[model samples]
Target chain A: MIDIELAFENLPPWAALLTAFCVFMGAFLTLTGSVGLLRLKTFYERVHAPTLGSTLGTGFILVGSMICFSVLRGRLSVHEILIAVFLTITTPVGFMLLVRSALYRDRVEGNDNVPEGNPTPGKQSAPDAAVQQD
Target chain B: MSASFLPADWPFVVLDWSLFIAQLFLGLAMACAAYRLILGPRAQDRVLGLDTFYVNAMLLLLTYGIRVASTIYFEVALIIGLLGFTGTVALSKFLMRGEVIE
Candidate 1:
């Protein structure tokens, strides 16, 4: 069909190749992040794995998709850009909050693995104890 | 499909093969993340697993878009990423503050 030809013809060979490469790379990174998430021994360490996929992997794939579509469409298709921006802004916040909460819970449970900070009752200093007593 | 569309020569074929291999590796990564999500000792670990899953899903969507030469896949990927981020934040807040409603 002429329509099909027109669409296929519009895509330059290099663009197609690049798109494929980008897609592969994106998938590869995501896969690696998942693997890292599972392989890591701790929750804190596990959090780091997904970021690899979220940050650079998503970036590369989005760019590649944008380029492929823009070139093929012969126009700037930027809706995907919004999603990218949203993810970038939110992923970190989510990760930080989750980490903080985990820390809080661990501390509350008196888990030995959590780092030291703001001593709890019975673990506080004399001045802190006096203040608490009052 | 026309002969021209079939892609001439062995080199391009080799490239495609390599790219396929790359995708396989990425898939492996997703499996790893899933394993962690399922095996984690705590709820945080599951949340982390889900977060990683979302990131990986986004990338996977991109790859599908590229393979199919469609822009729609990219949009889906973006949405997944956004949802993943929000969901992770919510879960974390619940874990930390003990109240997701707030």
Candidate 2:
């Protein structure tokens, strides 16, 4: 219902085209990342997939939006950069913890898919039963 | 007030349509994330789901900003992204250590 136009009047044709390309590319990457996250077989794999979206996808789209707005409004529009910064900084920490937890659970139940690491002796590697679920 | 600078053809039109389509795609991504949260065999999957949800929401807001041609939307979206990031970190740390405080 809301109709927002692309104000490309002032700028040359090339800038608009570039912005469009950036937006579409960003959207495509984000879509791919989400699809990969859903389709990946294992938890670790899924954890890696969405990072594509959080990283490059967010970066591209935010850049596109910022450019479009700045060109249209005739002023700087760099606030979206803050979102980019926050996401890039925090996403890895969350992902690492999630992976660690999954690894912990697998080891507690003795799963083979979970590779053993030198975290804690005897409890570090997942037992056999955990791997069966995989 | 800014109409003097406005182009003969409304620029918001292109931006809005593209953003609407983008929002639809982002919504689908959120749904996928939600599925993982619900069907997660373990608690970690749920946390991942929640984390994905937050990111998708932030992106959606950016698209909305494009739709409205207002920088205000971007600010709110930025805040949400920050809050979501912090919340996810806290939840994930809790899962890893069983105590978020430590």
Candidate 2 wrong stretches, greater than 4 Å: A1-13, A119-134, B1-16
Candidate 2 - CAPRI tier? acceptable
**lDDT (10s digit) by residue, model 2, range B1-102:** 567776644433444456666777888888888888898777887888888877877887877666566677777887888788778878877876779896
Tell me the native contact fraction for each prediction. Answer: 0.68, 0.43
Best candidate (score: DockQ): 1
What is the CA-based DockQ of model 1?
0.50
lDDT of 2: 0.73
Residues B1-102, candidate 1: write the lDDT tens digits. Answer: 357756554334543564566567666776776776787789888888878766766666566555556666766776776677778888887886678886
Error of 2 at B27 (Å): 1.3
In candidate 2, how many Å is residue A27 off? 1.7
